[model samples]
Target: MKCFEKLVRDFITSSLPASMNPLQFAYRHNRSTDDAIAHLLHTTLTHLDKGRDLSWSRHTNSLAKKARQCLYHLRRQRDFRLPSKVLQNFYTCTIESILTGNITAWFGNSTKQDRQALQRVVHSADQGQEDCEGPHPSQQ
Candidate 1:
């Protein structure tokens, strides 16, 4: 068995009630052989064979997914010729919230790749905003 799997098994066997079935527990795995991870409250915590470690890839990926979905809706509203103010409001209310939610907890610990991925989401939204600055279809 892998190191992480063994560690998880050991932890479960020790902490859980004997009467409770093991199948009820949910452990997050990326199929990695050396680490155990878990998802809690939109955050991901990881344990590695090297030592206790934190991995934010899962958390950042989920944030990117939610932000992209919000961006998609923002773009759709832009295509519909919604006013720039309304679009800005939508972004603030949706995408910004997704990107910033629990940011203080994970942003500092997140890897460079994960941080770059999130930046791309915001950059895409910025590009869309630049397009909005031009004469609107109705105005032109």
Candidate 2:
């Protein structure tokens, strides 16, 4: 904690008098390995098995919930006689965007369960999009 104390001391002297909020900081105990810290980057950092691993369970679950909500909206618009292209645009903007946001950062390391959960969202959206567009010309 010396480093943190030194930094706080320096900042207080150089800038306006500042105070630290005890609740805003997370400290990992020497004997604890299950502690996790979540940051604004939409991912959780965990120290497990003596190594640092990024857990995407929470992030994926959140994305799936949002994407499913978007899918509901897409289906509603389709029932309202919205154009196929407009529905496609909506899916792209809402559902797809949520699933793909920062994908490269966490997807590669995500567990299979997390990946499958996300895939289910995509699959449902795909089925909705297909229904929105009707049967393919070749299938007729």
Candidate 3:
């Protein structure tokens, strides 16, 4: 068993580049073991707190920050008298892309609170745009 373990470790080390630190997490009974698997690089693996419950807060926070920036720029463009269609296209390209890109992979892993927070951010952006235009043409 020890020899087999060594061979597996060796294979892993050989497969990955020297710059990367391969994290070996042993999952049993929906819980990760406390063993220090491998520490080649200085960076530790993220979202290892509760095994199956992968925390997406870091990724979601980054998305939210980016969305906020896009919204700020969109609002600024609106101030400069850009057409509503152009602003909508900008929102679709920039803000929506940030919100929906890679969503399928991480959405399921996100907590309810995290999802709600993201939804709120999106809603706020929509509301902000609507407020600037006094209701969309579709609504009228």
Q: Which number leads on lDDT?
A: 1
RMSD of each: 13.1, 10.7, 11.4
* Residues 25-57, model 1: lDDT tens digits: 443233322222223323333334136565789
How much is 2 displaced in model 3, in angstroms? 52
Off by over 4 Å in 3: 1-52, 136-140
lDDT, candidate 2, 6-95, per-residue tens: 787666556632463433333312312222222323333333423755476898899899888888898899889898889889988888
CA lDDT for candidate 1: 0.77
In order of listing, the candidates' clash counts read: 0, 0, 0
Of the two candidates 1 and 3, the one with more favorable lDDT, higher being better, is 1
lDDT per residue for candidate 3 within 20-94, as digits (tens), equals 433444322232443342231112334354365457888888888888878888878878878879888998999
| lDDT agreement with native, every candidate | 0.77, 0.73, 0.73
Residue pairs with backbone atoms closer than 3 Å in model 2 (clashes) = none
